[model samples]
Target: MKQAQIICPVCEIKISTLELPQGKNAHCPRCDTQLYRGSHKPLRDNLFLALTGLLFLIPCLFFPFVTIRLFNINFSANLVSGSYALMKESSVILGFIVLFCSVLTPLIVFGTVITAHWGLTRQHFTIFKYSLLIFQRLKHWMMLDVFLLGIAIAFFKLSEYATITPKMGLACIFLTQIVTIFLLSRLSVSRYWQRWQSSEQFQFDDVQTHCHHCHLSQPESQSCVRCGFIIHKRKPNSIQKTWAFLITAAILILPANLLYISIFYSNGKRYEDTIFSGVISFVKSGMPEIAFIIFVASIAVPIAKIIGLIYILIGIQFKHVTDYTRRMKIYLFVKWIGKWSILDLYVIAITIALVDRDQILDFLPGPAAIAFAGVVILTMLAAESLDPRLIWDDSASNTPQKESLHEK
Candidate 1:
């Protein structure tokens, strides 16, 4: 039996599906797309990395990531201990943020990967689906970038008190990031979906039997193959989530811009700058490139991303599918650029790491830095969790000629 043509999600082009023989790969007929071709990571390589990560996970959480040595009196704190100190001091918000970014996210990512591998070996699909969601969520909270910021700030602040340095736990934390990315890249999503499709127990009529929108024929539901519509899962939550996050971010941005993000000291004099003040300082210093980067990263890009996401989401929410192609373009742009908004976090980190001059100059990150980082990361994840196909659902109603005209 010939494998029927199916819509390609990325390209939105109908292509013939080629079924491979057992233990082989398939390709798309129209695009010549290699459906299951990914660089084969050796089994030994994966096992070695996973094992190394497991070994490091132990020390990464326990040993001190930062060591402060002041006048021969040394203090050490790791992920959990730091969080505890923050909690004891009643800095609950920072404590929770640090705990989630440094400890919980890594643990979840590593644990889910291990679980997924073990489940795959046992051929358990239920475990696979649960583990997949766990891994996806981890992508948001796994703030290697944010932790780096904290480390930089800690180093700068401790200059007067001590010579701060990273320790074994810090090294292990860094390694975990590499390990997580490596492991995830090894498992291709398209390939996994293809395998699920080929599995004998995975019958189409079993789960995806009915049309999602019309509850009619599986293929001929509310969706027209010629135009994509939600034959299932009508309200995709993209608009709702985008609007919610954008509004939340907008509110936070005000406080983040107004409150002091960091305090620097020079010759016993204090210098404090809010988010906006820092951007202005960069511009006044005759560093347009730096100024532009800080401006775009700290302010423009984030707001733009949020606003753009809202536009796309609203367009979908109201079933205003006329701009299907344009909406898709905007969606793609938002997806790609939102992550770079983390550049503000990078600035905070770099400043923390470098600015210290024996009380002549010192740097300390503030509440606003944390809040801004949260906004950037939260919005980014919200963007990721949103399904882009939701935008195309309404496209199914339009004829090909109409779609072509709209595209033009």
Candidate 2:
């Protein structure tokens, strides 16, 4: 293979490609950010995997995800019903967000992946372009893995009260998650571009500018020639938008954790649980493991995200450019863990769907669910609004006058 020129999205360090064995990625020498990893699998294999995952995921909505049995009462819940149940319990916004994150995003991503591969197979670059772009933009929002974890936590928490059994839908979703994650891990933007170039002369290698959305290097233009997403040196209005989101999230985090998040009724006795109280309940019930998970997801992650984001923002504002590696790690960690914070919402959605207003046992969404949802969403938006490249840019120069958010 011939050497190719590539620019690191983080530091803009132009690097010459080197031949590396399969399964290893080339990293930026300056910031250690991954720059390239060639996918070994053919597009056909990815197409088949995506199709398999979609087929499994579709049936998951119709079939029972889990069954609950308690004294003349039996009920089942699946993805669709869980969202509906959440909406009926007055947490409509949170319910819709959960539905979007778990169901719609994954479906679109997989569908796009298959179509993109189909386009590539047919040499239809137009179809390939749009589908691949959509896949790139939406893949991060897919939370099937977190949804699966929520399933386990819900089962453990509810087992103390009722007989809970996994159903075929659960099995299907599990397989879907595994397949999707594996496919995503193997999927890399550069591999497709290389494949395209091999078929014909392509301009990808000549350009040094990188698309953050797709991570594809192309000739500098208003939009990415490959993915069609708008291109920029760094995310537009990165710092200002991040601070706005973080401040809003910081305000909501307090109410989100302190107020009641869920209500349960068992044989005419009403019980309510806040984020902390719920975790404590799990510990009291001899499930400290589950308690810890809940604490981390529902309580710790949200706060940590806010504080971490604030730390990054303050560092940038003060031009604290030292510890580039530490700041970069904080940025990536915040982004990676932000979505997992929504795990509790899924648990609540599933539990309320399965046991909501059942006379024998029931669950209801409390006021805090919405607040908590806001906390999660805002923090995620905050993380996304931040440009990781900003850390490197700050390290290179502390020039405050260039590229001001106010300058247009």
Candidate 3:
């Protein structure tokens, strides 16, 4: 049996699915977007990883994740401490964001993965189908990888003044991230959907229409039969929606940089630092690597993303086909790097958790913390809203007469 043909969501190229060798990938011929990967590990392995990750989650949530020693005073913090600290400082919204990203999101991902795998293996088709749907929606919100990077940056910043040590819970969180990633790689939703169709002997007419969200073939349907997402040839008002988000993010970037990101008080002295000043502090402190990471994630990437989106939007508006491929690559790069912009926000959360103490020393979330977070989130939305397909549309229409004649 052959796989169904579908259109690439990113590039809008019609592609005929092929039987790929194990561990191989199918790429869109026109835009070079990866369409799908062949199955590698069995379902059972993914199940084991999911279950193991769940086991790791308990320790990560309960025990202290890191210990910091400053001025002969010791402070220990767990996964939940970051949220609590933020709330204690009256930043309730930021606290909730941290709690969702660090705790609730990971828990849901592991639970959904387990449910999907177990239900499928036990032939509980309904449970498997629903579980897979929820999993797909929730996966994008999982930010354990970004949270870990934030922890690294916080450690570098704090190590200059305090002695910091990783605890068992921190180790568990690290291990859980690895296991979750492995499970996700093996649990291919498309493969499972195909298997379910075969098992139920379900059949639909051969059609070229594809679900924008699930990227699955469907026959003249309003919603995807597999994932229930609305079927659309292209995202509605993609360019306009992207421009709105970009403009909002561009405006926020000014406040996000100019206002204070964090305030530190030690021995009756207060010090405030903005995003740029924070990066400069790291440089003056002689930790160039950490400074570079902060600079790129906080300062450079956001500016670059705004410019890239503007360039792509302009190219689309003018029907310019020159360097279309490079523009597509830029779109991909912007999307991939947007998540890392949250690194500084997470660093502040972790620092507050570990550094809060009376009179001797304490750190507080400053005005820019909220503004900076807004910039990160808005830019991410903009990247998601911008349709990469628009980058190739002009080139696709302007194909030389020789190529059109050959095809005909």
TM-score of 2: 0.91
Write down the TM-score of every candidate: 0.68, 0.91, 0.89
Q: Give the better candidate number (2 or 3) by TM-score.
A: 2
For model 2, what is the alpha-carbon lDDT of residue 132? Answer: 76
lDDT for each residue of candidate 2 in 1-408, tens digit (9 for 90 to 100): 345666678767666665666656667766677676644667677888899999999999899989988675788988788788777777678779989998999899999988887787899988887887788778889998999999999899888778997899999999999999888987876667656654124446366578775566667789876556788877889999998998888898888888999888898888989999999998988999999999998899999999998888888778886987888899989989989999999998888887765655788888888889999999999987898877777676432111101100
Full-model lDDT, candidate 1: 0.59
Error of 3 at 354 (Å): 1.5
Return the lDDT, model 1, position 36: 45
For model 3, the stretches where C-alpha displacement exceeds 4 angstroms are: 1-4, 118-127, 198-206, 225-228, 397-408
lDDT of 2: 0.81
Candidate 1: how many backbone clashes? 6
Candidate 1 local lDDT, residue 224 = 27
Question: Model 1 clash pairs?
Answer: 152-352, 212-231, 212-232, 213-231, 227-396, 229-393
- Least accurate stretch of 10 residues (summed lDDT) in model 2? 399-408
Candidate lDDT (C-alpha), each? 0.59, 0.81, 0.79
Candidate 3, residues 297-366, lDDT tens digits: the string is 9999999999999999999999986888889888889988887888887898899998877666789988
Cα lDDT of model 1 by residue, 306-400, tens digit? 78887877886789948776777777777667766665554444344344345765656677877786678667866775666577666764221
Q: Which candidate do you rate higher for lDDT, 1 or 3?
A: 3
